[model samples]
Target: MKKSLPKYFRRFLLACAILLALFGLSRLYFRLTDDFRLSNITYKMPYRQAWEVPEMSEAQRENFNEILNQKFYYVGKGAQSYAFKSEDDKYILKFFKFKHLKPSFFVDLLPSVGAFKIYKEKQVERKNRLLNSVFDGYRLAYAIHGDETGLIYIHLNKSHELNKVVTVHDKIGLVRHIDLDEVPFILQEKAKTTRTVMTELMNNQDISMVQKRIKQIFDLYLLEYSKGIYDRDHGVMHNTGFVGDKPIHLDVGKLTEDDRIKSKEFYKPDLLRIVSKFNIWFKANYPQDYPTLKAFMDEQMQLIFEDERV
Candidate 1:
């Protein structure tokens, strides 16, 4: 017992040392990468010292206006973002809504930094320019007037042909799978309050289609997230849309939690949540086919609830 106590104490001290080192590095990164001085300014969140985006020049404003004035097809929205693409087929845009944030936002965001605390909130307006640039399909964002942050990406106008829509549900395999508009109402509103907005995404046909798309999504998801080059908030139905059969990411944000699925932590729980979504989705969309979906969903639910011992 005496020896064990000494060993445990050493392990605790080591853990503390690592945490302190990380804390120091995070602070350094925050101080060095702080772009408040370099970027333009916009309206701050409801109550905070100053978390804002850089100001857009007159030219950027004109581009913004040109895009806004024209009509476009709605892609979908994520927790705090809404997306659309122009009719002329040039780019896709995503708008991020930043709600409540603290002054130490940066310190609270960026992994090595305030990750110890949850104060960062959205950190939306943070230089997403650097972040979006790191990935191929991801486009950089710009601060519009003051309402929200805008992200513009190269548009792939393939899904434009999908006129018939079906909501795909993986609800415990009873019924089946199957598969929106407006700055548009979707099948469901994820969050009711202003803190988070509902998200929607475009997909073709039904459950089978989403299943096929899953393999592709997994491929791309593994590619980007594995390297830690991109902070994929973990993909979801609404966070991804189809452009001529290709999956496109609809939302952009930072996930600083080191223990997240894509991070060091196991990703199964996150994937299981999606599976559960399939259950609820199936129950809602295809009641007749739901019983058929039970076994498949049951297997998944088993992994989620029963397989933990493995």
Candidate 2:
């Protein structure tokens, strides 16, 4: 305060302050009005029947129904969904996040200048596109790679008939009673992430056993590639998981049906993107095992690239 700032600098600071205040107020308003009940959700699988998968037999339906009746423990939340693991540890239910479903009414209040309107329209379009993409991806995964994806069922609308409820115990020790009848969720077979599984294997199992498991995961990836299914989200670590000995794509939202992914040129780079990170981590943490595993992986990759069967 000893020396006053220049006029333009002061103006810029004042503008920044105003913007910050507006942002704070907007956040507060959203927090205050946050509706946990999700009563105002707009999309509801409009034309499609709620349960359209005719492939599910009566026994499978009964099994799913029995599982739904049990209480579930809360798993971590992601950008798109809030995940919960079943009491029996056999299933996972991912309820779509409220933030993704909620409408942004502020966009409606903006004046309709040509550029502004177009901008707002594009935002809305993008939001819808993301929502649709996730739903469509799940459906496609279930249809094409159900075993690999562990996708059991997709519930896209509110219904009293289902009346599925769960008791969730979160990380903070808070208990939440949620009615799945109101929540849009995907039911899937439970799995541990690839990173977690791999770490445990490295710590507990012999190098040969670890190599076998890793090769199985690579084979699974190659199989999916052969089927023309590609996971847009690098399906190596977080997005991929192990259900027993089989590696499955856990994050099904970003899967895309691209035949080009079958080509070795496109596949190698995608494979390396995650493996290169692992290679560095292995060298630093378990230096003795690194060279052996690295050479093994290189040989396997070369074999994969050379094999015309994909």
Candidate 3:
């Protein structure tokens, strides 16, 4: 009996060892074969060198002018900006000057700093694509080319005046005209006015108007956050305003992905703060509108939280 007990114990030990080995082998296989590329793909700037504006070939120059001529509306300039219409007539372009590239001495770090601006452009592209897919009629705004330099020539025939058609200032670059009346109100302003305008709109009491605007604004931010867009210095909530009865999103530079997704500082706290302030402001100024806006925000946040879970 004792000898048979030892044999059975040996068999049990051997079976356990085989099972663990098989499990480890399966895990290793998956670790190697699964879609790990996304995890490994780090965004590093090309090692060649710092980007310099490439000289335009003759063909490239012609194509560039053709693209500009075919698309774009000319909006009037602000102190440091020149606006244009996007090809689709759905977005406005704000070109920044070289002087606007002042470094943030405190937070500027490597890898992230080099990738920041480009990441922002990519983020806008992702958000626009996602929103346009999820919301049937919604079209999120986008930033066009970040930086390009070249000599621009204007041909004014007898029918058109060069000055009236296009204004070419050395410092400001070229300003071309296209239809932009339908653009969101927020897109037309400097960054400083974004929060104030949003707060004012939230405080308006008209139920129908509040509902429409709140939906637009909420969708706008949802699109922004889902695409992993975050601007550390500016703190998300870029620009806002209405286009007709609907709200619009604008000024989407400085967006990027970060490890802070797990931190409350990233989304929850900031979102709560924005909503709380908005509610307070709404209650004080337009007591009648406060409930509608509050309800809209509550529903929107619920949707956001569900999406985050998935």
Candidate 4:
């Protein structure tokens, strides 16, 4: 009887091992067969352009060039602005200019900057991991590189077109000219258009259509927020037509370690801010759209706070 007991125990252990192996193999098969290619998505790189530095004297330009030459990239100027591109085609660079930096400022900002970089790296890893974990139907933006530097150069001529250049920057916070054009319309025009179109529809007593449209917008915002792919501000910007459809949370340069966790205090103010903007826009341009807007807000609140339980 004791010998038979040993035999049974060994069989049970063997069965458990087989089951575990099969489960792992199934997981691997699913991952391999998944249609989404998270690894292959290409982020938009800033294009390089030449900027005329009429403001700087020739001596200053020579000095600036000497300083910039130490780095591998060259600064170029274009029709309206300047940009930095790598000389060796290794990386795209953007320059952040500061007038004067005090010791206190550096002391305060350095830690935050380091934390932001770490958080950004973690977020990028999380994005890649989540792409394989579930079919959430959302893609998170990845930041390839970012840094702070005092001076940036722009070329004197438009030898390379916008798309081929390695680095580009705009005062409006766009990486490209196309994004610049789309951003203003997204931030200012789309929201107004949506409100106007909905209001006109509502005024004609098309309550059903108004509800449907509002719900659609609210759902999009909720989905964007849930994925952690966008902030509430950009969500509003995107919803209202302030920015392009592309997610804009890549400035993880400002992200804190606490931001990774679910914090109501952190997210609530931004959410309310967006709602306020929507309210102001609707009230000013289309008072008749208020009812639908309110319904949409309520739906967003429920979706954000209740349904997702975020």
Winning candidate number (TM-score): 2
RMSD of 3: 22.3
Model 4 score (lDDT): 0.38
Alpha-carbon RMSD of each model:
20.0, 5.9, 22.3, 22.9
Candidate 2 local lDDT, 143-209, one digit each (tens): 8899998888876656666655667665455576777666677899999887787788789857887
Tens-place lDDT per residue, model 4, 130-182, is: 32221111111211111110122322222222122122333333343221211
Off by over 4 Å in 3: 1-67, 70-80, 84-91, 102-206, 232-238, 241-248, 259-266, 306-310
Cα deviation at 118, candidate 3, in Å, is 30
Query: Per-prediction count of colliding residue pairs?
Result: 33, 0, 5, 20
The local distance difference test score of each candidate is 0.38, 0.75, 0.42, 0.38
Model 4 alpha-carbon miss at residue 121, Å: 28
Lowest lDDT 10-residue stretch of candidate 4: 181-190
Best by lDDT: 2
Model 2 poorest 10 in a row by lDDT? 33-42
Candidate 4 residue runs with Cα over 4 Å from true position: 1-207, 232-258, 261-265, 307-310
TM-score of each: 0.37, 0.77, 0.39, 0.31
lDDT tens readout by residue for model 3, 1-310: 4445587899999999999999999898655433121112112222221112344577855654454454445444443234555454544444432122223223234244556756655554664443223211111122211211011221111111111222222222334232222111122321223345555555453466555655655565554455554433233233455444444444333334444543544777656655675677667877776777788777777776665531
Model 3 residue 35 lDDT score = 16
